[model samples]
Target: MDTILYPLEWFVAFVMVGFHKIFSTIGLNAESGWTWALSIVGLVVVLRILLIPLFVKQIKSSRRLQLIQPEMQKIQAKYKGKKILSPARSRPRK
Candidate 1:
C-alpha cells in the first residue's frame, strides 16, 4: 500500500511546495501557517477549474441518456410477452 501511495503522496507534496514557493516569491509571509493554508486552498481552486469541463460533459451525457431511457423501456415493453428458447430446452433427454 505504501508503494502504491508513494507517487500520489509525492505529487500532492510537490503541488504544495510549488505553491509555497509562489507565495514566498510574492512577498507573502511564507513561514506563517496561513500561507500554507492558502497554498492548499489555491490547489483546490486550480483543480476545480481544471475539472469543470469534465463535470459539464458528464451532466450533458446524463441528460441525453435520460431522454433515450423511455424509448428503451418502450422497446422492452413491446417484447415483454415474447419467449426465448434455450439450447437445453431444445435438446432431448436420454
Candidate 2:
C-alpha cells in the first residue's frame, strides 16, 4: 500500500512545502507553528478548488440518474420474472 501511495504522498508533500515557501516569503515566521498549520490549510483550500469541477460533475450525474429512476423502475417491472437466455440458447427469429 505504501508503494502504491508513494506518488500521492510525494505530491502532498510538494504542495505543503510549496505553500510553506510562499507563506514564508510573505513574512510569516518560518519557525512558527502557525506557518506550518496555515500551509496545511492552504493545501486543503487548493485541493478543494481543484476538485470543484469533479464535484459538480458528480452532482449533475446523480441528478440525471435520479430523474431517470422512474423509467428504470418501469423497465425493471416490464422485465420482471422473465428469464434472460443467451443468444446461443435462443431460437433464431423469422
Candidate 3:
C-alpha cells in the first residue's frame, strides 16, 4: 500500500513546488513557500479533525485493553500447563 501511495505523495509534493514557482513568476503572494506549507499543514489539520472520532475510539479501546490485562494474564496462567507439551508429543499424527 505504501509502495503505491509513495509516488502519489511525491506527485503532490512536486505539484506544490511547481505551483509555488508558477505563483512566484506571476508576482503573487503564493510565491511564499509558507502558502504551500500552510496549505499542507491545514490539510493535515483537517484530516486529523476528521479522524478525531477514530482516535478517541482507539484510546478508549486501549484503555479497556489495559484494564483487562490482569484478567488476561490470569487466563494465560490458567492455560500455561496445557501449553507446555513434550517436544515428541507435540508433533502431529498426520
Candidate 1 accuracy as lDDT: 0.90
Evaluation by TM-score, superior candidate among 1 and 2: 2
- How does each model score on lDDT? 0.90, 0.96, 0.76
Q: Model 2 segments beyond 4 Å from truth? A: 76-94
Ranking by TM-score: 2, 1, 3
Compose the digit string of candidate 2's lDDT tens values, residues 23-47. 9999999999999999999999989
Clashing residue pairs in candidate 3 (N, C-alpha, C atoms within 3 angstroms): none
lDDT tens digits, residues 6-90, model 3?
9878866776666666655667586476667755665566557888999999999999999999999999989886867888899
Best candidate according to TM-score: 2
Measured by TM-score, how close is model 1 to the native structure? 0.68
The C-alpha RMSD in Å for every predicted model, in order, reads 3.4, 4.2, 5.6
Q: What is the TM-score of each candidate against the true structure?
A: 0.68, 0.73, 0.56
Candidate 1 residue-wise lDDT at 39: 91
For 6-72, candidate 1 gives per-residue lDDT tens digits of: 9978977888889989998888897799889989998888778888999999999999999999999
- Cα lDDT for residue 84, candidate 1: 69
Better of 1 and 3 by TM-score: 1
